[model samples]
Target: MQWLKVIFAGFIEIIWVTGINTANSWWSWLFVLFVIALSFYLMISACKHLPVGTVYAVFVGIGAVGTVIVDIVFFGESFNIIKISLIILLVIGIMGLKLATEEGDE
Candidate 1:
Protein backbone atom coordinates (compact mmCIF):
# COMPACT_ATOMS: atom_id res chain seq x y z
CA MET A 1 0.00 0.00 0.00
CA GLN A 2 2.78 2.38 0.91
CA TRP A 3 4.63 1.54 -2.27
CA LEU A 4 1.45 2.19 -4.20
CA LYS A 5 1.27 5.65 -2.69
CA VAL A 6 4.83 6.29 -3.76
CA ILE A 7 4.00 5.17 -7.30
CA PHE A 8 0.93 7.39 -7.46
CA ALA A 9 2.91 10.29 -6.13
CA GLY A 10 5.55 9.73 -8.76
CA PHE A 11 2.95 9.82 -11.58
CA ILE A 12 1.50 12.93 -10.02
CA GLU A 13 4.96 14.41 -10.07
CA ILE A 14 5.05 13.81 -13.82
CA ILE A 15 1.67 15.48 -14.25
CA TRP A 16 2.59 18.62 -12.37
CA VAL A 17 5.99 18.91 -13.95
CA THR A 18 4.34 18.68 -17.37
CA GLY A 19 1.78 21.16 -16.19
CA ILE A 20 4.50 23.60 -15.27
CA ASN A 21 6.03 23.35 -18.71
CA THR A 22 2.77 23.94 -20.59
CA ALA A 23 0.34 25.66 -18.26
CA ASN A 24 -0.74 29.14 -19.43
CA SER A 25 -4.20 29.56 -18.03
CA TRP A 26 -5.31 30.17 -14.44
CA TRP A 27 -7.21 26.90 -14.21
CA SER A 28 -4.22 24.93 -15.46
CA TRP A 29 -1.99 26.57 -12.86
CA LEU A 30 -4.49 25.72 -10.17
CA PHE A 31 -4.55 22.10 -11.33
CA VAL A 32 -0.81 21.97 -11.17
CA LEU A 33 -0.83 23.26 -7.62
CA PHE A 34 -3.42 20.71 -6.60
CA VAL A 35 -1.40 17.87 -8.06
CA ILE A 36 1.77 19.11 -6.39
CA ALA A 37 0.08 19.10 -3.02
CA LEU A 38 -1.33 15.64 -3.64
CA SER A 39 2.03 14.23 -4.64
CA PHE A 40 3.72 15.77 -1.61
CA TYR A 41 1.11 14.37 0.72
CA LEU A 42 1.48 10.92 -0.82
CA MET A 43 5.25 11.06 -0.50
CA ILE A 44 5.05 12.01 3.16
CA SER A 45 2.60 9.27 3.90
CA ALA A 46 4.77 6.67 2.19
CA CYS A 47 7.89 7.90 3.97
CA LYS A 48 6.34 7.17 7.34
CA HIS A 49 6.46 3.43 6.60
CA LEU A 50 9.31 3.10 4.10
CA PRO A 51 12.98 3.96 3.85
CA VAL A 52 13.07 7.60 2.85
CA GLY A 53 15.98 7.26 0.48
CA THR A 54 14.41 4.35 -1.35
CA VAL A 55 11.07 6.02 -1.53
CA TYR A 56 12.47 9.27 -2.84
CA ALA A 57 14.72 7.58 -5.34
CA VAL A 58 11.89 5.52 -6.74
CA PHE A 59 9.61 8.50 -6.87
CA VAL A 60 12.09 10.60 -8.77
CA GLY A 61 12.95 7.75 -11.09
CA ILE A 62 9.34 7.30 -12.07
CA GLY A 63 8.86 11.00 -12.60
CA ALA A 64 11.98 11.23 -14.71
CA VAL A 65 11.14 8.29 -16.92
CA GLY A 66 7.52 9.28 -17.27
CA THR A 67 8.42 12.84 -18.16
CA VAL A 68 10.75 11.75 -20.92
CA ILE A 69 8.09 9.55 -22.43
CA VAL A 70 5.54 12.30 -22.14
CA ASP A 71 7.87 14.64 -23.94
CA ILE A 72 8.23 12.23 -26.80
CA VAL A 73 4.61 11.16 -27.13
CA PHE A 74 2.71 14.32 -26.36
CA PHE A 75 5.15 17.16 -26.88
CA GLY A 76 6.65 15.78 -30.09
CA GLU A 77 10.14 15.78 -28.70
CA SER A 78 12.59 14.01 -30.96
CA PHE A 79 13.31 10.41 -30.10
CA ASN A 80 16.72 8.86 -30.47
CA ILE A 81 18.50 5.63 -29.71
CA ILE A 82 20.57 7.31 -27.03
CA LYS A 83 17.51 8.53 -25.17
CA ILE A 84 15.88 5.11 -25.23
CA SER A 85 19.09 3.43 -24.11
CA LEU A 86 19.47 5.76 -21.18
CA ILE A 87 15.86 5.27 -20.23
CA ILE A 88 16.32 1.53 -20.25
CA LEU A 89 19.38 1.84 -18.05
CA LEU A 90 17.46 4.02 -15.66
CA VAL A 91 14.66 1.48 -15.44
CA ILE A 92 17.15 -1.24 -14.60
CA GLY A 93 18.59 0.92 -11.86
CA ILE A 94 15.17 1.67 -10.43
CA MET A 95 14.33 -2.04 -10.43
CA GLY A 96 17.64 -2.84 -8.78
CA LEU A 97 16.93 -0.41 -6.00
CA LYS A 98 13.43 -1.74 -5.53
CA LEU A 99 14.69 -5.31 -5.36
CA ALA A 100 17.51 -4.40 -3.00
CA THR A 101 15.19 -2.72 -0.56
CA GLU A 102 13.96 -4.95 2.24
CA GLU A 103 10.88 -4.51 4.34
CA GLY A 104 12.91 -5.00 7.49
CA ASP A 105 15.10 -2.08 6.52
CA GLU A 106 12.18 0.30 6.85
Candidate 2:
Protein backbone atom coordinates (compact mmCIF):
# COMPACT_ATOMS: atom_id res chain seq x y z
CA MET A 1 0.00 0.00 0.00
CA GLN A 2 0.99 3.65 -0.13
CA TRP A 3 1.74 3.69 3.57
CA LEU A 4 4.18 0.85 3.05
CA LYS A 5 5.96 2.82 0.37
CA VAL A 6 6.33 5.75 2.72
CA ILE A 7 7.73 3.55 5.46
CA PHE A 8 10.20 1.98 3.03
CA ALA A 9 11.27 5.39 1.85
CA GLY A 10 11.88 6.45 5.44
CA PHE A 11 13.88 3.29 5.98
CA ILE A 12 16.00 4.03 2.94
CA GLU A 13 16.67 7.51 4.20
CA ILE A 14 17.74 6.18 7.58
CA ILE A 15 20.06 3.66 5.97
CA TRP A 16 21.63 6.26 3.72
CA VAL A 17 22.18 8.63 6.61
CA THR A 18 23.70 5.97 8.86
CA GLY A 19 25.93 4.87 6.04
CA ILE A 20 27.40 8.34 5.86
CA ASN A 21 29.40 7.63 9.02
CA THR A 22 31.24 4.76 7.32
CA ALA A 23 31.64 6.42 3.95
CA ASN A 24 35.34 7.24 4.10
CA SER A 25 36.56 5.51 0.93
CA TRP A 26 35.50 6.25 -2.62
CA TRP A 27 33.74 2.90 -2.88
CA SER A 28 31.78 3.64 0.27
CA TRP A 29 30.77 7.00 -1.11
CA LEU A 30 29.56 5.33 -4.28
CA PHE A 31 27.35 3.00 -2.26
CA VAL A 32 26.05 5.94 -0.27
CA LEU A 33 25.18 7.74 -3.52
CA PHE A 34 23.22 4.72 -4.70
CA VAL A 35 21.29 4.63 -1.43
CA ILE A 36 20.51 8.32 -1.69
CA ALA A 37 19.17 7.85 -5.21
CA LEU A 38 17.01 4.97 -4.09
CA SER A 39 15.69 7.01 -1.16
CA PHE A 40 14.62 9.81 -3.48
CA TYR A 41 12.91 7.41 -5.83
CA LEU A 42 10.96 5.87 -3.01
CA MET A 43 10.06 9.29 -1.63
CA ILE A 44 8.63 10.29 -4.99
CA SER A 45 6.54 7.15 -5.09
CA ALA A 46 5.24 7.87 -1.59
CA CYS A 47 4.31 11.40 -2.56
CA LYS A 48 2.26 10.11 -5.49
CA HIS A 49 -0.23 8.59 -3.06
CA LEU A 50 0.17 10.75 0.03
CA PRO A 51 -0.06 14.51 0.09
CA VAL A 52 3.29 16.01 -0.89
CA GLY A 53 3.46 18.20 2.19
CA THR A 54 2.63 15.36 4.53
CA VAL A 55 5.06 12.95 2.91
CA TYR A 56 7.88 15.45 2.94
CA ALA A 57 7.31 16.37 6.57
CA VAL A 58 7.18 12.77 7.63
CA PHE A 59 10.28 11.90 5.63
CA VAL A 60 12.29 14.66 7.22
CA GLY A 61 10.96 13.92 10.68
CA ILE A 62 11.89 10.28 10.48
CA GLY A 63 15.33 11.03 9.08
CA ALA A 64 16.12 13.53 11.81
CA VAL A 65 14.95 11.32 14.65
CA GLY A 66 16.69 8.26 13.22
CA THR A 67 19.92 10.14 12.76
CA VAL A 68 19.89 11.32 16.34
CA ILE A 69 19.28 7.83 17.66
CA VAL A 70 21.98 6.36 15.46
CA ASP A 71 24.44 8.98 16.60
CA ILE A 72 23.72 8.27 20.21
CA VAL A 73 23.92 4.49 19.87
CA PHE A 74 26.68 4.00 17.34
CA PHE A 75 28.77 7.14 17.47
CA GLY A 76 28.72 7.60 21.23
CA GLU A 77 27.14 10.98 20.80
CA SER A 78 25.89 12.75 23.91
CA PHE A 79 22.20 12.44 24.67
CA ASN A 80 21.63 15.59 26.58
CA ILE A 81 18.32 17.13 27.52
CA ILE A 82 18.39 19.40 24.51
CA LYS A 83 18.78 16.49 22.13
CA ILE A 84 15.82 14.72 23.71
CA SER A 85 13.73 17.84 23.52
CA LEU A 86 14.49 18.26 19.83
CA ILE A 87 13.54 14.66 19.12
CA ILE A 88 10.25 15.18 20.91
CA LEU A 89 9.59 18.27 18.85
CA LEU A 90 10.22 16.35 15.66
CA VAL A 91 7.66 13.73 16.70
CA ILE A 92 5.13 16.40 17.50
CA GLY A 93 5.67 18.07 14.15
CA ILE A 94 5.20 14.80 12.30
CA MET A 95 1.97 14.13 14.18
CA GLY A 96 0.70 17.65 13.57
CA LEU A 97 1.36 17.35 9.85
CA LYS A 98 -0.48 14.03 9.67
CA LEU A 99 -3.43 15.45 11.58
CA ALA A 100 -3.64 18.46 9.30
CA THR A 101 -3.69 16.24 6.25
CA GLU A 102 -6.41 14.08 7.79
CA GLU A 103 -8.49 17.15 8.51
CA GLY A 104 -8.09 18.28 4.93
CA ASP A 105 -9.22 14.88 3.71
CA GLU A 106 -12.28 15.11 5.91
| Candidate number achieving the greatest lDDT relative to the actual structure | 1
TM-score versus the correct structure, for each prediction: 0.96, 0.87
Question: What is each predicted model's overall lDDT from 0 to 1?
Answer: 0.96, 0.83
What is the clash count for each candidate, in the order shown? 0, 0
Tell me how candidate 1 scores on lDDT: 0.96
Q: Compared with the true structure, what per-residue lDDT tens digits does model 1 show for residues 1-106?
A: 9999999999999999999999999999999999999999999999999989989999999999999999999999999999999999998998999999986976
lDDT (Cα, tens digit) per residue for candidate 2, span 1-106: 7666776778778889988877899999999999999889888987877798888888878888888898899889998999899899889989888877874442
User: RMSD of each candidate?
Assistant: 0.9, 2.0
The Cα error of candidate 1 at residue 63, in Å, is 0.4
Clashes of 2: 0
Q: Which residue pairs in candidate 2 have backbone atoms (N, alpha carbon, C) closer than 3 angstroms, thus clashing? A: none
